[model samples]
Target: MEEILSQNEIDVLLSAITSGEMDAEELKKEEEEKKIRVYDFKRALRFSKDQIRSISRIHENYARMLTTFLSSQLRTYVHIGVESVDQVPYEEFIRSISSLTVLNIYSMSPLKGSMVIEINPNVAYALLDRILGGKGTSVTKTESLTEIEKILLNQIFEKATGTLKEAWSSLVDVSPVLEEFEENPQFIQMVAPNDTVVVVSMSAEIGEASGMINLCIPHTLLEPIIPKLSAHYWMDNTTDERDEEAFQKLSSNLQTTKVDVQAILGETRITINEFLKLGINDVVSLEQQIGDPLTLTINQEPKFYVQPGQLKKKIAVQILEEIEKGVNTHE
Candidate 1:
C-alpha cells in the first residue's frame, strides 16, 4: 500500500526549506570552528600563532645558551633573557636602538636577506673590560669607541652567533655569518627601510651591570620557511623519535644494573660423623673431574660454564659456554 505524508508534515518540510534552517545551522557550525582565531594584518601578520610560539621557544633556548656562554667567558655569573618577541617596521626597529651601539649584521642561508643584533654600549664595554683582565664594571656612556674595541667586540658577537646556531638546531640547521659591524644605525640597512621585521628583545645582567639586546630578523628572509616554523609541524614529526630516544635511554640504564655472580667448582656430600671427626688437613674428594669447567650462576640462576684461570695476579674464569635452564651440556 502506498502511504502519503499528512498535510502537516508537508507544511513542516516547506517551512524548513524556506527558512534554510537545516543546512544553514550546519554551515554556521563549520565556519565558526574555522574562524576562532582573529588575525590582524596591521601588526605584520606574516607569522602565524604557531610560528610565534616556535620562535619564542627557540629564543628562550638562545637566552639560556648565551647566559651560560657569557658567564663562562667572563669568569662570572651572567644572566640573559628573552624579554619579548614582536613584529614591527624596520624603521621602528632602527629607531629603537641607541645612538652608540654594536650592530651585528648576519645572514642565514636558504633565507633571502640578513638580520641585525644590537648590543647596548654599556654591555659591550663591560664585556671588553672583563676580557682585558679587569673586574667587570658598569661603564659610563662614551662619545665614541675605538677601532681596537670594535675588533674585540667582533669576537664577542661571534660567540653570540655561535649560541644562536645551537638554539636553532632542534628546529632547523642555521649558520649565522657576519656581514658587517656598524655603530651608526642610519648607515645600516639589511632590507628595505619600511619592511617588517621580527624583533627579539632581550636583557643581560652581570653583577651590578645590566643592558638590553635586540635582534631584527627581516620578514622577507623568514618567508621561505613559514611551513617549518609552526608548532604542529614539529610536534607531529618528532613525537615518535622522542619516544624512541626515551626508550633507548631507559634500556641503556638497565644495562648498568649490578648482579651477583659466583662459580660452583663442584659439589660433595659428607656424613655427620665424618664432619665432626674431620681434622684441619683432612682430605675430602668432590664429585668433579680435575679439568672440568665450573658452572657460573648470576642471581641464583646458572648462566655459564667457565674454566678456572689466573689473570695477572687475580683468579678469574674463561667462559666456555652459556647454560640453559634444565640443560646440562657437560653431562
Candidate 2:
C-alpha cells in the first residue's frame, strides 16, 4: 500500500512540472508576439583632403577670373574664413546648403572706433561720382552725400548683386544683400559682432579716379549656410569618363617624351622682310652670338645647349648642360 501511494505522488508531481513548463513556453511566445520590431538606416557624406583642396582651388580661380572680367581698377582680394573647422559633420552640411548672401562695403571712417568693415571716404566718393557722371575730384568734404548720390549708390549695389547672382547661379544659389552702414552704429553692431568675416577688397582705377569696394561677410551669418555652401560648391559629380581617359592618354604621351619643348622658345617673331633679305653668303646675325652655346630645340623648345661635334662621319651635338630656363620658358 505504501509503495503504491509513493508511485502515485511521483506521477502527480511529474505531470505538474510538465504543465508549468508548457505554460512558461506559451508566455514567452506571447511576449515575443507582442514585441515591436524596429529597423534603422543611415547615410553619410564625406569629403577627402584632395576634394577640399580642389574646391578651394575652384573658388580661388572663380574669384580671380571674375575680378579680371570685371576689369576692376582696384586690386581685389578674396579671403575665406572658416570658424569651426572640425565641429560640424561634413556629410549633412554637404547636402543642405540653400542660399548665399554677399555684403559689399564701400567705405568706412579712418578712425577705428568699432570692429567693422573699413572703407576710405575717398573711395565712396569716387564710386558715387562715377555712377553719377560727376568728376571724382569734386567730392565735397561732408559726412553725408546728397539724396541722389545715395540712390545711385544703392543702384550700384543692386546691379553688382544681380551680376554676381547670374554668374554664380550654375555653381550655387547665391543672393546678394547690400547694406550701407555709414553712420548707423546699431546697424553695424547688428551685422558684425565678433563674427568670422570674409573681406573681398576690390580697388579700381577708372582713368585718373581711383576707388575701392570692400566686401565683408560675417561668420555668424554664414554659419548656418555652410552646409549649403559645401553641398553647392564642394560636391561636384560632373566628371566625364571619356574626358578623363583622353587626358590620361595625353599625359602618358607627354611623360614618355624624353624632352619637352614649349612655345616660349619660338615665340620671338621676326618680320618677313628680315627673312627675305637674308642670303646664304651674307652673314645674317641671330640673337645668339658666335661662341655662345647653341640651343638644341626639340618640338620647338630648347631642351639642351650643345657645341657641334663629330661622331665618325655623322655630325652630332654633345650636351653641355641642361637648360636652366624656367619650365614655362624655352632656353
Candidate 3:
C-alpha cells in the first residue's frame, strides 16, 4: 500500500523549493541515478573484457598454429602473434582497413551474418613474390594483383581459414569460408554503421618484413555464445573434467601404448651394380672395427650405442651408451 504525504510534509517540500534550499541540478542527478541504465539502441553491448580476453587466448593459439602452417606455405620462417582483441563500431572497423589491401568478408556457418578479415598488402605481396622464388621484400607500392597473385592468395586464404576453424574448435565448432573479396571497404554494407564488432588484430613477421592482419566479427553474432567466451569458462575448463572413469581409462591406455624400436649394426656404401652382383654368402665390408659398438635408432633417430650379442640364442644389442641428442625419451 502507498502512503500519502501529510499536509505538513508537502508544506516543508514547498518551502525548501521556494527558499532555493534544494538545487535543481542535484534533484535531476538524484532522479537520473534512480533510473536503470540508459542503453543506446544504435550500439549493442556484446563482449566484456573477460570475454574478449578469452577470445584473445584462442587467437593466441591460432597465431601459433598459423606460424607453423604459414611458414610452410610461404616456404620461409614466418611468425604470427596476436596484437589485440577489442570491440569497436562497424564504421571504425572500416576506417582501419587500408585503401587497397587483401580484405575479405567471410561467412561462419551457424552464425548470423558475415565477418571481415583483412591482410596488409605488404604481407600479401611478400608472400606472392616469395612463393614464386623471389626475395620477400617490403613492397609498399600498391599495384593491381596479377592473375597468378590472385591464385596464390586463394590458396593462402583457404589454408588460413582452415587454421582459424581449428583455433575456434575449443570454444565452438565453426566453418569459416571466404565469401567476398573487397578492394574498397567503404562501399560495403556488412552491418549497420553504428553496430559494434569485435576486432581480432594479429601481427605477422617473415625475416625482415612485418605486417598486420585483422578479423572483424559482428557483436550480434557473438552475443549468442557470449557465455562460452567468458574468462570463467576458460579458467574452469582445466579442472572441470567430471568423468573419472573415462579419465582413468585414458590414463591406462596411454600407459600401455606400444612403440617400435630398431637396432642398427653397421652401414656400408655400394653402387647398385655391385650390390646386385653380390651373393647371399658374400660378406660386405663396413668402415667400422670388429669390436666397435653398434648404433640403435628409434623413429629414424640415432639414440643409443649398443654392442651386438646373443642372449639365450636370440640376437640382440646390449646397451653400451645413450646419446643425448634429439628427443631423449629413453633417459
Candidate 4:
C-alpha cells in the first residue's frame, strides 16, 4: 500500500514532528559540558624553576655555575611555558613563564613553524662536545654527526632523571623518555598544535668555547606535571620530617655553661747575646720577687694575693688578702 501524501498533509506532519520535542534544556546542558575543561594526560612535562634547578644539580654539583656556563656557551637564555584548556598563545606563555624570577628568556619565537627548539649551531656543537667529554673544537663538520652522536645527546638528557632523583630523593620521580617522533604518530600529534610548544634556550660557556642549549616542550605535554613539580619545590615532606627529627634530637641533649678565663700579667725584655751567653749556673734576674705578694689569679684574673705552702703531701696556695686597688704593680 503505497499512498502519496498531499503537500498540506506533508507540511502538517513535518510541523507536528518538529513541535513534538523542544530540547532547549538539553542544548543548554551540552553547552555547559563543552565549557568544562578536558584534562589531557599528555601534558605532564612542564617543570618549574625549582624543579629544573634541582634536576640541573644532578648533572653538576654546582648548579648555578653550570647554568652560567650553559648561558655563556649557548648565547641564549632559558624559558618556561604553561598552557591550559584556555589555549594560551606561544608568546603569551613565554612571557608568563619567563616572568619567573630565575629563568631569563631572551627572545621568544613565533608558533608558526614546527615545534622545534632553535639553538645556535656553535653552542649546540660545544654542548655536544662537552657532554661527550670531547674537546669543544673536535666538532668540525655539522654533517658528520653519526647515529652514536645523536644517541649520546639523548643519553645525557635521560641521565638527568637519575641526577634529580638522587638530589630530591623520593619527592619526585621524573624520568626523561625519548620517543622517536618520526615513527610515533602520537609524538607528532602531541606537538602539532601551535600553542603547545615551549622553548627553553640558554647560552653556556664551557671553558674557551661558548655554546647554547635549547629545549622544546609541547604545552599539552607539560601542564599536568606543573602541580607536581610545584609541590616538590614548596612542600618537601621528607626534608621537613628529617629537619624536625634533627631538631628534636638536638633539643633533648643537656646544656652546659662554659667559663672563660684569660690574663695578661706582665712582660720582660733581655738582650739576645746575654741570653745565649748565660750558663746553667749563672743567675737570671726577673722583675717579679719570690715572696712579694705572688699574684693569686682566679680563672686567669688577678683576684687575691696568695703564698705558696705545703699541705700534708701536696703543695697548696693560701689567699693572703684580696687586691682591691688598681692593677698590681711589680718592680
Whole-structure CA lDDT of model 2: 0.46
Q: What tens digits encode model 4's per-residue C-alpha lDDT throughout 1-331?
A: 9899999998886676689754656767998999998776434344555655433433333234445444454454422222112233454334432211111111112222233233344544665766655565424453534577557655544443333234333333443333331211222333334354545444454534554444454555544544544545455654664577777777776244344433223335789998889887897666666657566665666777767777998977777777776855543
What's the alpha carbon RMSD for model 2? 17.9
Which candidate has the top score in TM-score? 3
Q: Candidate 3 on 189-239: residue-level lDDT in tens?
A: 888889998899999887557899898888877877888987678778777
RMSD of each: 14.4, 17.9, 9.2, 18.2
| Per-model TM values vs. the true structure | 0.62, 0.36, 0.69, 0.35
Q: What's the lDDT for residue 170 in model 2?
A: 44
Ranked by TM-score, top first? 3, 1, 2, 4
Candidate 3 CA-lDDT value: 0.83
lDDT of 1 by residue, 1-331 (tens): 9879999998997788788865756767998999898765545567776787788888999999999989888897689999999888888888888887888898876566888889887788888888888777768866777889889888877777888888878877888888899888999877776677999989988755789988888888888777888777788868754578888999999999999999898899999998999999899999999878999999989999999989999999999999987889887
After superposing candidate 2 on the true structure, give the runs of residues whose Cα lies further than 4 Å from its correct spot: 1-119, 134-140, 167-171, 177-186, 225-331
Report, for every candidate in turn, its global Cα lDDT versus the true structure.
0.84, 0.46, 0.83, 0.47
Between prediction 1 and prediction 4, the one with superior lDDT is 1
* Residue pairs of candidate 3 with colliding backbone atoms: none
Q: What is the lDDT of residue 252 in candidate 4?
A: 72
TM-score: model 1 vs. ground truth: 0.62
